[model samples]
Target chain A: MSEPRFSVGQRVQIADRTPPVHHRVPSYAKGHVGVVERVCGMHANPELCIRGDGKPFQRIYRVRIPQTDLWAPYEGTDGDKLEIEIFEHWLELAQ
Target chain B: MTGHDDHDHGRTFQPDHPEPTSDAALVGLALRELLIEGGHYTAEEELAVIAEMQGASPENGGKIVARAWTDPEYKKRLLINGKDSIKELGFDLEPYEFTVMENTDQVHNVIVCTLCSCYPRALLGMSPAWYKSRNYRSRVVREPRAVLSEFGVDLSDDVDVRVHDSTAELRYMVLPQRPAGTDNWSEDDLAALITRDSLIGTQRDLSTK
Candidate 1:
C-alpha cells in the first residue's frame, strides 16, 4: 500500500459485499461499522494474490467494533468489542 | 510412522495418481522435494526445522510474557511491536505482524481466526486442537463471554471481552495481567505460571498456587 487512507480513531465500515472468492474480510464483519484501532502497515492485496497477481500492496487497519452493534442483544458486557484486521479496500468512511 | 518412510522413498507420489490424503500431501511433498532438488535446502535441513518447531514449546510464549511482567519497558515495546520484542528474546515471528493484546481489570482479550484457523505458530507453537475446530472459530467471535466461561474463565459481567480475529498477514498474542502475590518471584518461576491458553486469552489469572 502506497499510503494509508484511514487514520486511527476514525469511524469506518467494512464493505458488505460478498464475492464467492478467497478473501480476507470475514463475512460477519461485512457491512458493520467500526473504528480504526491500528494502522497495521502495508500487505500484498490478498484478493489479487489469490489470483497469483501480487503487484499491488494495500494498507491494512485493525477496526474495532462494539459487540452490540455486530450482534443485537449481545450477551457480553456493554463494553465488549471485537477488533479485526481489514484491508484498505474493504473499508469506507462512515458517518 | 509412515511419514518418514514415505519421505525416504518408500512410496512414489505421482501427481496424476492422487489419493484422498495424497492430494493434500502433494503440496507439501512437492515443496519439500523442490527445495531439496534445487539445492535451496536438504532433507536434513528440513527435518531440523521441523524438529525445532516441534521442540518449540508454549514456554516460548511464557518466557516472553514473564519478561514483560518484570520489565515495563519491554512490555511497552511488546504491546507496540510484538514480533520484534519476542525476537529480542531469540524467538522469531517473521513475515506476519504480531500484535500483543493486554488484559486488565476492565477488559479481557481473546484470540481467534474466523476466516480460517490462523495463529502465531512461530511464537506460540501450534495452536490448540480446540482453536482449529470450526466450533471455536465460528462461535467465539459471536459469543465470546460464553465461550470464555466454557474455557473455565467465568468473568464478572463488568469486564469487557475483546476478541481479536487474525488475518493471514497478522497475528495476535495476549499479555495477561501479572498475578499479584509474586512480585519477588524469579522470571523462570513467573514464566511457569503463564499457560499456553492464557497466552491465547482463553485462560486468565495466572495462579502462583
Candidate 2:
C-alpha cells in the first residue's frame, strides 16, 4: 500500500538500467527526463505478470518528454513532445 | 484444369525463404477441429466473434468523432471518461480503457505502441502495417515532426506535437479539429471526412474533401 511517488506535472527521470529481459520501458526513454502528464492508474507490471508471477500493481503515469532531449540529433520543431507511459518503479525524481 | 504431371515442382520451390506449403494450414485445421470436437469452444462462437470483429472499423470511431464535433456536452463527457462515453454509443469497449486526445489549433496528438501494437481495435479496427513497423516505433518518438511530415501532416514550429505511447492497458484515439466550411453539414458528411489515419493524428486537414 505504498503512496504514488510522482504527481501530475512533477519532473522525473526513467532509470537507465537495463533489465534482464523485455520490458515496457522503451530504450529511448531510459535516462531521459520528463514531466508527469497524467496519473494513468495502477496496473500489473508486464515484466512480471507476463511470466505468470503474481505481482503488486504499480502506479503508471503518462510522462511528457521533449523530443530534443530524447534524441541528440533531433531536428524537429522545438515544441514537439513525446509522451510515454512509465511505471513508478522505473522512474525517479529528476535532479 | 492442368494435370499434376505437367506442373513444375522446381519452379514453385523457394530458396531463401520457403512458404509453409499447406503443412501449417493442415496443422491449424487439425488443431481447430480437435478444439471444436472437445467442446472447448463451438465453431459457431468462433465465427460469431470473427464476424463481430469484422463489423468493427474506423466508421465506429468516425461516428463518435462526428457527434463530438457537433455536440459540446458529449465531447466534454468523452474527454472526461472515454470508455463510458463510447459505451453510450452502444459499443462495448472491453479489455482496455479508451482515451480521446483533443487536437486544438496549437497542439496536435499522435499515438504509438512502443512495446507492442496496442490500439483501439473495438472502434478503429486493426492498425495499419506502418503503425506496427520498427521504423515507426523507433523514429516517431525521436523525430515526431519528421515522421508526421512523411504522413503529409506538416505543422508549424509554433504548434506543439504530442506523441502518446501505449505502454499500459489504456488505448488512445485523437479527436481532430472539426473542418471548416461544413458548419451545417450532416453527421454523416462530417464522419465521412474522418479517416483512419486522421483518427491516428497523421493527417489534420480533413477539409480537403
Candidate 3:
C-alpha cells in the first residue's frame, strides 16, 4: 500500500467507527479534533475485522489535544494535554 | 440453583491430590524460563514482571513511563492519542488497549477498569495486584480523594479530580512532569527519577538526595 499522508501540527479528527469493540482509540476522542504532534514510524495496524479484509497498513501519527477540549466543562489545568497514536485510516483533516 | 446446590452438597472432596498444571500455566512457565535463560532479563526483572502480571495495570503504566522518559516527542504524542499513541513507542495493543489521562496542578486524573483490571499493558509492564482487586476498583471512583490519600497523594479540594473508567479498549497512564531537582540531568538520570508510583499518580517524583 502507498504511504499514508499526514504531517506534524496538522489538525485532524479521529474517524468514527461503528459498533466499536476492544480498540486502541479512546471513545472520548472519537469525532474530536486534535493536532498532529508527531509522525511515528510505520507499524502494522492492529484494528482488524473478522473477515480480515483490512490488511495491515502502516503510517501511525501521534496526536495531541488539550484535555480541556476533550472534556467539556473541564475546569482544571488549562495547558494539560493528552496524546494518542492514530492510524492513517482512522483520521481525517479537521475543518 | 437448588438442583446445583444439591449436586454440590452430594459431591465429596478428596484431600489427597496431585495438582495438575493447566496448559496455559505450563506454557507461561516455560516461556518465562526461556526468557530468563536467554538473558533477556534477570531473575529479579522476571520476578518484577511476574508480580506485575498478577495485576495488569501497574506493569502497563511502567511501560508507558519508560517510553515517555526515553522519547521526547513520544511523550508529547502520548498526551494526544493515549491509546494509539503508545504504538509509536513500540508496544502492540493486543487483547487489551489503554487510554492515557494527564494530571496537572489544577486537575488530577485517575483510571480504573471497574469491571476488571483494564490496563495499558503495552506501555506499562503490568498492573499492581491491588489494581485488579474488586475492592479497589469499586471504592476508588466513589472516594477518589480518600483513595488517593491512602497512597499518600493528597490533592487539594480545589484540584478537579477526574476518574477514567478503563472499560473499553482504552487504558490510562499518568504522565508526570519531570522533577525539578534534576534540571540538567540526562535521560538516564531523568528516568531514574521516575518510579512506578509516580506514573500511577500514587507518589510524586523523587527528590534529589
Q: Tell me, by lDDT, which candidate is best.
A: 1
Clashing residue pairs in candidate 2 (N, C-alpha, C atoms within 3 angstroms):
none
Question: Lowest-scoring 10 consecutive residues by lDDT in candidate 1 chain B?
Answer: B9-18
Which segments of candidate 2 are over 4 A away from where they belong? A1-3, B1-43
Q: How far out, in Å, is residue A9 in model 1?
A: 0.2
RMSD of 1: 4.0
Q: Write the per-residue lDDT of candidate 2 for residues A1-95, one digit (tens) a residue.
A: 57788899999999998888667888878899999988766777777875775278787888989888887887767688888888898999999
Off by over 4 Å in 3: A1-95, B1-73, B95-97
The alpha-carbon lDDT assigned to residue B31 of candidate 1 equals: 73
Candidate with the greatest TM-score versus the true structure: 1
Task: Give one digit per residue, the lDDT tens place, for model 3 in B1-209.
Answer: 22333432112111233332788856765775567558786556645655555545444455566567667788777776665776664566653444455566777766666656766554555667888887787666545567778888777756766665553334566777656655566665565556666666666445556
Q: DockQ of all candidates, in order?
A: 0.81, 0.63, 0.08
lDDT of 2 by residue, B122-184 (tens): 799988999999999777777788899999998897789999988877899999999878889
Better of 1 and 3 by lDDT: 1
Candidate 1's DockQ is 0.81
lDDT of 1 by residue, B80-109 (tens): 988788888998777788899999999999
